[model samples]
Target: MAKRVLILSSSPRRGGNSDRLCDEFLRGAAEAGHQVEKIFLRDCTIHYCTGCGLCSREGRPCPQQDDAARIIEKMVCADVIVMASPVYFYTMSAQMKTLIDRSCARYYTEISGKEFYLLLTAAEPDRQLMLRTVDTFQGFFDCLEEAHLRRSILCPGVWNVGEIEGHAALQEACEAGRNC
Candidate 1:
């Protein structure tokens, strides 16, 4: 039952807290014999969705020529999708949101039945601070029929880059991936 796992790391900062957790999750997933790939949004050229409605209108391809479509293709083929982001202003990063928006072309049909894992990090210590962020992810999940949220790791109080170097949540993230 090896799953094709895709980890989308949407941290603007390279090696940021959330990205670190993503790495740990990747490591654990790999150790557990899952086929894993981690895509860093910072390295991808994903443009913002313009709501042009072309994607939804005719089931046509997105007019914007960017990496978003390719990423969506990967998501469509993945059995498990892990979206990791640094909580920005109580929500997922713009990169993650934009990617989700751009998936309008095939989300309902192609992105169905996938297991999702949410990994988020924030400066706020209270886990409740991430509720809004979780809700944001849930909004996308709700659209994809049978796309269940399998797990969520909220690592709070880590703001600066590399701050999660020794955080215990890193291990928790790894364990989550291992158990996946």
Candidate 2:
């Protein structure tokens, strides 16, 4: 069976390590016959969450009238949501974090039961911190009715474009994608 997979890539550099990982993952998914869509956050205009809570209260749905809401809609439509970002200061990029914060409406209604995968790359290779970041997703995503976290790929010590060219784990990431 083919699944619709949406990948939100937050890397600003083209063909960067994070981008390469995403490409590998998508390639595996495509080879498995799944439909995949990758959205680059750097090219999109998305604002940070204002904490207005209007999306949860008045149903305003993301006060920032930019591309954030549309992206969320794509996320809702997909069977799997893969967030690929380069970690900054031991956390996800601001672009990725902002999009997640702005997706409050989905927390309650839209994508309540959707599956999610996280792909994080960092300059420092620390499995413990990367696992912690993956765990942080639980706070916002665990409440969904039937949400399942299939995998979280943390490719560390990659800070340049093409740095992951010959990394062995990249193959594992592709395999992970096939299973998605």
Candidate 3:
């Protein structure tokens, strides 16, 4: 069966380590006969959430009109969600965090119950340190009922744009996506 796979690449810079892995994942998933689409947050005009509390109030809709709602709608429709981010300051990038915050309106109703796969990259070499970023994602995962974290590929010790190139983790990402 062909599954709908939506990949959110949150790297502020295109072709960044995590984003590169997302490309590989896309390639593998496509070869596996899945309908895959990747959303590069860098290209999207995502406005910061204003916390107006309207979206929670009976279809009042978000006061700020931007790409967030559209992205959330795609997220709601996807069978698999790949969240790829480059970790900085021991956490996800600001773009990814902003997207999560913007989803506050439809989180419970729309963003829950999907298979999640994480692709994270960081300069820190220690896997334990990288797990901190995964832990951060776990906090978000805990809020979404039935959100299964199927797998995660963490690429540490990568700082430059092309630093992660040719790494074995890239192949692992392809394999993971193919299996999905």
Once fitted onto the true fold, the runs of candidate 2 whose alpha carbons sit more than 4 angstroms away are 106-108
lDDT of 2 by residue, 35-143 (tens): 9999989899988778887777787756577898889889889999888878777667788888878778555457866788888887777767777667667666765
RMSD of 2: 1.7
Clashes of each: 0, 0, 0
Q: In angstroms, give how far residue 57 of model 2 lies from its true place.
A: 1.7
Q: What's the candidate order when arranged by decreasing lDDT?
A: 3, 1, 2
> Candidate 2 — what's its lDDT?
0.81
Candidate lDDT values, in order:
0.90, 0.81, 0.90
Question: Model 3 lDDT vs. the true structure?
Answer: 0.90
lDDT of 3 by residue, 47-150 (tens): 88887777776567777778988998899899999999998899999999988888886745667779999999998888788888998999888888789999
Model 1 alpha-carbon drift over 4 Å, by segment: none
For model 3, which pairs clash? none
Q: After superposition, which runs of candidate 3 have C-alpha atoms over 4 Å from their true positions?
A: none
What lDDT score is found at residue 172 in candidate 2? 73
Candidate 1 lDDT over 48-114, as tens digits, reads 8888888788777888888988999999999999999988888889999888888886645689889
